[model samples]
Target: MDKNIKIADSMLDLIGNIPLVRLNRIGKETGAEILVKPEFLNPSGSIKDRIAKMMIEDAEKSGVLKEGITIVEGTTGNTGTALAFVSAVKGYRFVAYTPKMVSNKSRMSIMLAYGAESEAIDIQDYNKKMGLDADDDSSVHGGHVELLPRQICLDLERQHDDIWWARQFSNPWNVGAHHDWTAKEILEQTDGKIDAFVASVGTGGTILGVARALKAHNPDIMIVGIEPAGKAMMGAPDEYPLIPGISDGIIPQIFNSKIVDRVISIHDSDAIDMAHQLTQKEGIFCGISSGANVLASTMIAKELGQGKRIVTVLPDSRDRYLEVEKYTT
Candidate 1:
């Protein structure tokens, strides 16, 4: 109530400036110091808030998004929730299409809570409706199980003047947000001494964007990308992720191979195990993709040895996984 007190005009103002915290117990055995950006601290409880705000504001500047238009996007969950959060604040209607029975129900619920429409697209159901066999390869073209939802957004955008698909996978602003804000904050926090940067590849925006900045600051910084076991996100021809955190090997357009030095796959079990370790040992309380990133970071930390510093991101909060029992089980 003090006149001098500072306050945010909107939740949008709290979306960035997420602080980096050092891991004390979990990665101590690795000898190298592991620092994690607690991106879940963002307003919507995930790093996607950064891109959601960026994409919407950029669209406003470019006149693609205007009053009375409904925003549409295909997401696993985080991006949809983030966009819903932003749209609710900015007075736009939001519609998120996610793969049916795949995304965490908690996240979809959060989107709906923000007054957004959350639709689950059942691929096999659509295939059957379209006169294709349930097992047809074309049903999930590009080897991505989530393609059906994206196609729905595309169709809606093409068919309606009031519909604008955010297209986070290919959107330049998705990369721009991290490159301009997330990476800058990391550099400022770490003083540009990062020896390695690691993150789970969802849409591939975070790792690629941060890698660009970290590489420019210090070309020696190793950029490591994490993939769910069997998913070849870094240039391999045919493989897909098992966990919902990683994408379905449909390499996002925002991802660039030039900045990435390595792609490591972590099993779902290993990721879940590490998530528990992060919660119990380090008090991180992150989701499975965060587990994948930290596990891979620990691997790199050991390889880098003592005195090396590695940075990664806890992409979302454990609350999203609470009902799914991904961490509880």
Candidate 2:
């Protein structure tokens, strides 16, 4: 028997250590090697599982999360699904506050399946209620679209003793998870030979965390971040689209610009096209952000040319996108 094949005590125990594989066909013309970490292989079918576990456990250790405490978070889909998965396994109630515009039936169903209660907040409604115009700079700025949902989480935490907000956006644990585990896994898997890293920025935790580790490993390693076109959380104008997993426009507090070398914006059509290619050619069933990440990775690979390696993540599975977008077909 192989010593590495030990059984896990629980699903939570299986969150990380996802394998990194090279893209054989998609980036063939790039010359450089494009490696992908299929984070969808995580227990909850998304990379968010890592931070969900990390934040929850850390809160438990700090005594902020207690018996019967409900875990609440503002998420698009993946984080909520992950928190629900972790909460269900750990015996905690979970609630997800999500943007009404980006809400998808499939994503909500997965969270509901895990016994999580989800509340979709309409940004337009919130803006109207607050007497702010939809086009107002304050309401349309980077990541402002998610502010209402996060505010709801904040209110719940402040009003109820039994409720604890996961705060995945501002939580240091979100960054810590990728830095300590995800990036370490990448470094180990690649034997510290990675020349670049690319990822689609949502809460910005993944890229920020991974950049911190990869840059520390080798400062010259380029770190690139992808955002939906015109919806960049850094400085671009806020825009709406079907790009479900990223660019909801609230520049998360965890986002740090210094470590990131470049920010690339990809259109929804481009992401969908890349997603189709990934599914059809490479057999990697991933979501739109994964498409953006992989697309950005290929661009980086082409720049670096032959012999260099670029690593990126397939952030989530395609199941959440089947009902809403043409991500696969």
- Looking at model 1, residue 204 earns an lDDT score of 82
lDDT of 2 by residue, 36-114 (tens): 9999999889999999999999999999998889999887678889999999999999988877765667878889999
Query: Candidate 2: minimum summed lDDT over ten consecutive residues — where?
Result: 134-143
Q: After superposition, how far is residue 14 of candidate 1 from its true place, in Å?
A: 0.5
Clashing pairs in 2: 142-249, 143-249, 143-250
Structure candidate 1, residue pairs in collision: none
- lDDT per prediction? 0.83, 0.83
lDDT over C-alpha atoms for residue 170 of model 1: 89
lDDT of 2 at 159: 99
lDDT of 2: 0.83
Native-to-model Cα distance after best TM-score fit, residue 298 in candidate 2, in Å: 1.3
Q: Over all chains combined, what TM-score does candidate 1 have?
A: 0.92
